[model samples]
Target: MTSSRSETAYQRAVAAFKNPTLDLLHRRYAPFVVSVLSVMFTAERPTVPISDAHVEVGTFVEELRAAGYDLDERTLPNGTGRDICRSWARVGWLVPQITDGVELYRLSAQAVGALEVAGRAGGGRAKVSRSRVRTLLESVEQLTQSAETDPALRLARLRDERAALDAEIALIEAAGDELDPIDDDQLLEDTENVLHLSRELPADFVRVAESINAMQRDVIAELRRDERPAGEVLREYLHRGEHVMEATPEGRAFAGALKLIGDPEHIDHLTDQLQALLGKSFAHLMTPEQRGELRAIAKRVEQGVQEVLQAQRRASHVITTQVRTHDPIRDREVDELLRSVMSGLQAWVPDSRAGDRIDPLRSLPTAGVRHLRQTVSDPRPPTAPAPLRDPGEQAEFVDADTRAWGGPNYAELEAYLAGLEAESFDLAAAFAGIGDAETRRPADLLGLLEIAHRNGLVESAEVSVVEALRPDGTARRFAFGAVTARTLKVESHD
Candidate 1:
């Protein structure tokens, strides 16, 4: 007769989400909120404590400025950035954490859902990867019911799979029994799928941590309630929270992610295969910078996961301490003391202080609409807030890669090495010609040695000096030595 709990929940969720003003957040406050979150969520490690909040705000403002935001860092109110954090908290996208009377702010579980929606809705603006479909298919195949419980359905599915397998086997076992290996096209798609999944590891871990944090709060609240002894409640919720973290959907997903990141061999293999794939057919799919990111992604993902796991450990200790000293003796003592005090108060008498009051009820106004004082005052029109307008700046956010990829990579350096033909290598002169001075530090003299070793072209070498161009369009000189060509090789455009 009544709507189901889930349906009721859906209705409540819809009502809660249907706020006109709140919906405008993405438009009005998105530049600040999204940029900060973009960095906060994706940053390798962020500790935005109250101690650093002031400085962090200024740093973020500077970053935005570098990104061409026209807003003045100085003009921003002392408390302007903190207000956004508070606003997010009010909107349920952030949770303010407290530990031992200290406060910390973090993203709520819902924030991930919001970010995911934004990413799906073209906010990310990344190409719709070919790997997505493969990911979906693989997910379905892996997650489908197993043979243990749904034997009949499993049998049917297995039979269908067997049919497909048989077809493949037949093709392979035919006349010559030669099986066609997955070719470049399949390899491209497979590499993409792997990269896509690997890239998602950090974000997935962040969201899982968010979810676990939500559960931990719930557990703490349940344990702190006076309905039962604190120890019992704490113990119960601790076990439950641990189980949920270890066994539930988010937990399992996190565990799987951890497994992928935690295995050094797997990471090494993935990196090597990815590098190999990138140098081949998949090369065109990604930038040199992106390739670099994929190569180093495993360590970053592992660090994020470890941070989350460490947080869980800290939370466990916090919950234990919260209920460790709950004693029924102290509770009963307080209760009996309260009862005795109440009995004494009941038995004792007090002098009346009510004798001095005038007729309070009679002094009040009895008129419904008449005899009330009326006053009129001049009214002025409400003034709107001053419009904030600075033509938004357009400078780009620069990073190490921006500086590195600005000029060249090892490949380019090697090419430059081959291009030298004055009977010996000229490291500085070659790099100078290629405008790679600022890109590769002048102090990195070891690069010349590396190039020779890699190509096995150094039968002899010596330190030499030359000048190169800086990004500021100035020439700077450096000494990086030279190497003789051991093998006969010419500069190939390839």
Candidate 2:
């Protein structure tokens, strides 16, 4: 019988598989049996070994066993081999040709195609031929027939077909360097719709669309810069439109300025010059309160600068004097002693008389010694004897007893006390003549007090004592006990 075109291909594929160089083994079963088995294998049959005819028989029996067929391999006339042959014939891997009581089996042509395709698919040294395609198509046809009632299977098949068509279209387009006109029209329509939507949208949406339009325009302009005949000027127009849509008044002004000042480096300098000119020309442009506030701030800054310079000068003088001085310790001792004595007198004297009597004589050693003996003796150590005096002397005295008992040790003590007396006398005279003497300004007294305090001649309290003297003639008393000479010196100065 003359073979159909597909049948011819199948025969050719089978012939290739049978070639010695290909090394594909098939059973020496009947041609019909072999062909049937081959077609089944090609149709996605489970994997199995293909040997000679008896080997195929063996494989058939095993498959029967796997499929729960209850035939006994050993009990058959030809053992499992004949049973496999029987099973193959039953399952149509083989077909039986019977005459009278005798039966013969032949391989099926479909089975031959199946075996050839299966061998090639499994890397079995056989190349796929035109016959394999026909076999695969035949198998697909059979599957479609079998799954006709399954919606999911039908959908999967349709999807696979659509994917294949899509891939084919893509390959054709790529090769021809031509896009589909339909897709191009669709894209143009999409672009127009997007623009329309952007125009009709809410403010925030319009802003986002404007930004996207700007980006698109920028991209197009950059592409155009490559000298390609593209929509460069159109893109710039689009960008301008986006800017107009999105810009605030300040943004517009800034944009105008940026256009005017094209050079970024000079822009800052230009801005500064403009600001200065504006400030000069528009001084009246500011409100009265605003101008007042500005002036106040300027005044405060000026005052602050003056204060800083003054403090610096004072500090420099202090440091220089400190460096030049022989004994800071001696000065401190004198100031403390003076302050101590003055504080004592301030405590004992009435407020009215306190300023007149105590204030005037505070820095005098005579006044200090008298005040100390009278007011500050209580807290002195018992071991410290009273300041001694001459037997006939009426004034408060500093003899052996007084020297021993007065706060610190004697030799050091008398020296500090004497220093205190001298400082106090000078300070008292200075204070008393403040208004009368050109050199004796209240500022001079304050400067002296500041120096005395800075030099550690007296505690800060003693300086406050002077301030409390208050040319108004009221005395201010503060607590002190066993005071140092530094405090006494401060009191004397006050």
After superposing candidate 1 on the true structure, give the runs of residues whose Cα lies further than 4 Å from its correct spot.
Answer: 1-27, 40-43, 46-53, 62-108, 112-130, 142-204, 218-224, 246-248, 255-281, 325-494
Per-residue lDDT for 73-125 in model 2, tens only?
43222356656566665644544533234444443323333443453455334
Candidate 1 lDDT, 363-428, residue by residue in tens: 656567756568877586589678988642643665523443243355555655565566555444
Clashes of each: 4, 55
TM-score against native, each model: 0.48, 0.14
Give stretches of model 2 more than 4 Å off: 1-285, 288-310, 339-494
Measured with C-alpha atoms, the lDDT of residue 168 in candidate 2 is 90
Global lDDT of each candidate: 0.59, 0.43
